[model samples]
Target: MQKLLYLLILIFFSTVAVAQDEDRELLRGTVLYLNSVVTGENVINANTRKATITNNAGQFEMLVKKGDTLVFSAVNYKFKSVVVTQDILDKRRMVVEVKEKVTELDEVVVTPESKERFLELEKEKYKKYDYERDQYTRLQNYATNSGTFYNGINFVNIFNALRGKKKKDQRNNEPLKVSQFLREMYEDEFFVVDLGIPQEDIGKFLFFCDDKIKPADIAGENREFKLLEFLVDQSIAYKKIPKE
Candidate 1:
């Protein structure tokens, strides 16, 4: 609902209303009860059905002619109406008012989306991003009750790697894109400080992180917290790798 300031019928005149149509002209207006501007209210002309909304400044412009009725409506505001008259047409600009209903926003429920679903969504959004070489990277996931989750090959990812046809579709830029996207989401501190993955080894560490879970799977989604959780847990397993 818009803010309410019980206002007297305010009739003001500015430059003549701009009538673009043979019969209609442009009418500028403001929706404010006091001196403060109201936001998010729709102002509509009932006769012509032309519409505009009160912006941050509570100002709007719409096409209008004499005898057209202007209606103001919003989620929290009581309906207010005014009619365009000859005097209003001469003025071109006017200020009006709306009364607010004492109410609150409706409740919203939030739930986490499945990682696979997020992956599918990102794939659709970045469909232009070619994923090349199903033959290149083998992947496996092993569930765990404690310590770091280890991805063990049980055969599925092996088949993926063996699929020769998948190689033809692989985009050469996907690996680079994956790294770039990760770098963009995470600051250097996340790699060097939080994960204890050195700046020099960050690139290799991301390669290691791709074994079980790839950030590319959910690239567009703003689920950085989920990525953070995965990275923290994955670093433990990464550290276990013997330094060459």
Candidate 2:
């Protein structure tokens, strides 16, 4: 009987809470809390396509009905959205957490090809037309006379090319900054295949390591060693976080 009474009481409170949430939906407007002072956050209503910008204080008031979708976007922050619920409308306030967006520039690799191979490819590109034709012969002669076909090597140019190549090779072989290195490693097959980290949590995991490892600390000859050490120390702690 006692257990039955306790169960009834629990159900009663749950029903009351749900009813209260429903009542909140009847309310007119909602006040949003911007966790950080994000200027110019665009708040858009999905249904109507209407938009509003958050004030400098990072707060916005939008009159929304239940089930209305609100999308929040900013230049440097990741976009977020919320569907208005009865409870949220009733409370007349919502707290929003926005993460700063990080953009990584694409890596460009410049490798010099052998001069002989380069010339061969260049000549072959123009060889689609029959060289026996008068027009083709004239075009080829003009190109050769104008130095367009020249691949002659100057000592100064060769020296600079070698020096540039050396620098490029050195940089390619150098240890990456800790955060970048971690980000790259996160995308590697080893992390997913071996460590079993999901792709979506890669960013979160990297952010968690910000305080633990500094960029300069990993920019040395022993970068791999330092990186391994940091990973070993933090992987356990990271795994402890409950998944949503």
Candidate 3:
């Protein structure tokens, strides 16, 4: 009889609890930023049956049932969702915090062939003009003012070529063509460099010879071409012939 009474009491409480749960009404709350800012109004609606946006004061209300999910969304912020339980439904109001999302753009790349072609055309158009000498002089001055990275041998040869001084010894010793030079540079450096500055900034002032030196033909040499590869990769210089 004692065991029977105990079982009866357990059954009665369970039924009462079920009845109470069924009688409970859904409650709604508005979503807002942690700072209490109202990003938008009326963003939430009923097909999202249990959701609604906050008003100007960042306040909103909705009907929610036990176990229903409420979602909040805005154009400027990431969407958020939370589940409503019996304890939460008892509250007169609820506040949800939303966070914003951020996006980043990819790096832009300029092609070496196009840049080289542009420089070549410019050089051809200006080669015989007196103005071209001034341009070359300015570039040489800039290079000289910058500390020498390789004993100035490369710049000396380049300057001589620009000045039309083709000493036989220098001709024989001319540093490899720009393409070859790039390949050599790349072989030595483990990383690449960006050389996408405007042609006027570096092109008119730097080496502009195209036919005199082609990169594609010289990339096959086994010597260190780290800097050369870096230049080619960065689009500062290009191989006239495509590498196989």
Candidate 4:
């Protein structure tokens, strides 16, 4: 009878301790932009400072507790914070919508001369910068000068060439800078796991994508989605190439 009493006492204490413990649970959620998945965004627990990033499907999971504050942050998206509550904990899944930081101007007036000049610049790019070499000469010249870019123009790779090296060196290495930018932008798993390019072949696959379309062509514009789409297509093409 004493042993039975002691066992029940232990069980009661264990239940009390469990009931008093903090309600920490894994919360799963998707981030959406234009109703499409927004990958690579950050999900942070403001309380614990633990964090995780969204995957390709915009899904993310992180340990959150009741009353914990969750922070959502990413480039080109507005910063957001949410307070964890009983309902959120019970549901354990959420959908977060992030508003793009880009602002739409209500009205803009364009002068005829400016419009003509823009069109003229568009036409001049083909003749101005040699397309076959991907404008090596222009890039070399721009080593000390930040060149101008216009719409519908390709091969204006100012995003790369971070440091102004000597003209000869810049000319030789400027083209590879686009691939470098891409490499720095994403983790290796993006190429291997997400894109399905083999771990050893990431460099080769990036080069293949660069050759198809200069990933840096759309400078000063939101390029994440386009870059992801392009890489997906290129990865498909890359897998088809016969290996030695």
Top TM-score model: 4
TM value for model 3: 0.30
Q: Provide the lowest-lDDT 10-residue window in model 4.
A: 107-116
Cα lDDT tens digits, model 1, 36-139, are 68998899888866688999999999888888899999987789999998999999999997776557565322111233443344335333432232211123
Per-residue lDDT of model 2, residues 78-154, tens digit only: 87888988788668777777776666554322111233333334345444645434231222222222211211212
For each candidate in turn, the TM-score is: 0.34, 0.31, 0.30, 0.36
Arranged by TM-score, best first: 4, 1, 2, 3
Better of 1 and 4 by lDDT: 4
Any idea what lDDT model 3 has?
Answer: 0.47
On residues 99-176, what C-alpha lDDT tens digit does candidate 4 reach at each position?
Answer: 887555643322222344433343454356444344223333334234444332222344545333335474464444
Give the Å error, residue 194, model 2.
36
Candidate 4 whole-model C-alpha lDDT, 0 to 1: 0.66
Ranking by lDDT: 4, 1, 2, 3
* Model 3 root-mean-square deviation: 18.5
Q: Best by lDDT, which number?
A: 4
lDDT of each: 0.59, 0.54, 0.47, 0.66
Q: Give model 2's clash tally.
A: 1
TM-score for predicted model 1 compared with the true structure: 0.34
